[model samples]
Target: MAENNDLASGDDILASYHLPSPKPLWLNAVYARHIVRGNFMALSARPPTVDMGEWVAHQVVEHWRMLVTFIRLVHDKDETGHTICNGRTCPKMSAGPNHSFTWLNSRLEPVEIPAYEYLSLVQRYISTKIDDAAVFPNDPTGVSFAPYPGASSSPSSPPNSGGGSGPDWVGRRSGFPQNFLDVCQKIFRQMFRVYAHLYWSHFEDPLYHLGLEKSVNSCFSHFILTATTLDLLGPADLEPMQALVDLWAANGTFPQDSRAYGYANLRAGERLLALAGATTAV
Candidate 1:
């Protein structure tokens, strides 16, 4: 039957696409920093030495990992539910052709992102900046690698570098000609804007129109919790939704009552901000 064939085709499409999986939520604590007092003389003026680049890369991948997880949670598999704004519904659209949205970056600084430009920019950013070691976006298992108009041919797909968490980076960086961590930070800054736009601009549509409150709230909580635990986000990055978070916590939407997360009774909201305050720099 045609319906059966279509079902099989759908399975094939899903099978060819690859997305990162969420880490066990409890594992976030393992990466949290703690204060350790030492002999004043022995401690020295400088703090402990660390691989700053690689460390930031880990944060980048983890944040992306959670972002992908949340996207999957809220996206309708049938493709009938996800709203295609196509620029008309965007607030910037009403201000004439030259309008732009003020997007927040990794440092919480506001930047001008032009209206209707994000989708293509994101596709280009992911295509060009993604780790050369991982599968290029056009590799059958990617998220529509060549998304921009007139784009043809995928980027060069490099062989696996092995041990990378999510095709962002993993083992061996000496071969790279650029400072890898700086690139990762750039990627994170842009990606954060994407997340902010989703929560800020489209939060209600998904909740009311799509009936995805449970999924949206849960996914966002995970995103906030993970970002907080990793020192990837600062106060300014989260301030816009502080009230929403409080409301969710008060209603028991976060630290979901599921044993799988290992923290059903955890007070996540306050702790999330606390961790950010402890780690984030001004």
Candidate 2:
């Protein structure tokens, strides 16, 4: 778990980012329970002998690999003639008319790009982060993941030891770096964007046509469950697909009390309409 910066008590941190119980998923319940939920429990338990973070890193890496394949399947999907997703058809990286994403260039400035380009960048970004030995250290070889660029110079941030924590462990040191949470959060956020883009833009064509609606629902629902339960994502991050989350909560795919559900301060009605138009089957 990431430590609190303000020297806040453990209870304070818990209250700030609570871990809600996992609700049984309507789609792929068995997989979600056995794979996602089981891993989370193991992490939370923090067994004395096991390197829990390393185990979690492996699971997260595998999940991203699967998610990348799933999204690529949609991108490469064929309908009648042309491909489902392309630069000309999807001009912007957008979940809806309301939510548009911009990419950071080499200079670290946000730049508008085409959807395909944006997703490609996202894939590259995740790959770079995971492969960075500083962030995902190799235990046997002992190279660590990167810390924040100027983490040591900053007074508020904690210092990071450059030691490797094996494959999944963020660090081999006594405490986990706050930067690990930051990196994982960013990764999950980008992944969420892909799911949002697929549901909003390509649901009817490739998703429905290819009969992948349930698969997407199953995967995304499990994704949401895992991400939220572990606090990798927050209410603001989930704003793009708020309506579908609400629908899931109503139907019990997510717990009613889960922080991942029912936090739509943004245009709730518009999102509901978007969800309704996307699919009523869920």
Identify the leading candidate in terms of lDDT: 2
Model 2 agreement with the true structure over 146-237: per-residue lDDT tens digits: 35433321112233444555333333343345477667778888999998888777766666677666667767876776677556677778
All models: lDDT? Answer: 0.38, 0.57
Q: Please give each candidate's TM-score.
A: 0.42, 0.64
**Which one wins on TM-score?**
2
The per-prediction CA RMSD against the true structure, in angstroms, equals 20.2, 11.1
- Candidate 2: residue pairs that collide: 54-168, 54-169, 133-144, 133-145, 134-144, 134-145, 134-146, 135-145, 135-146, 139-166
Q: List model 1 lDDT by residue over 138-159, tens digit each.
A: 2323211212233211112222
Candidate 1: which stretches are off by over 4 Å? 1-83, 91-115, 134-178, 248-282
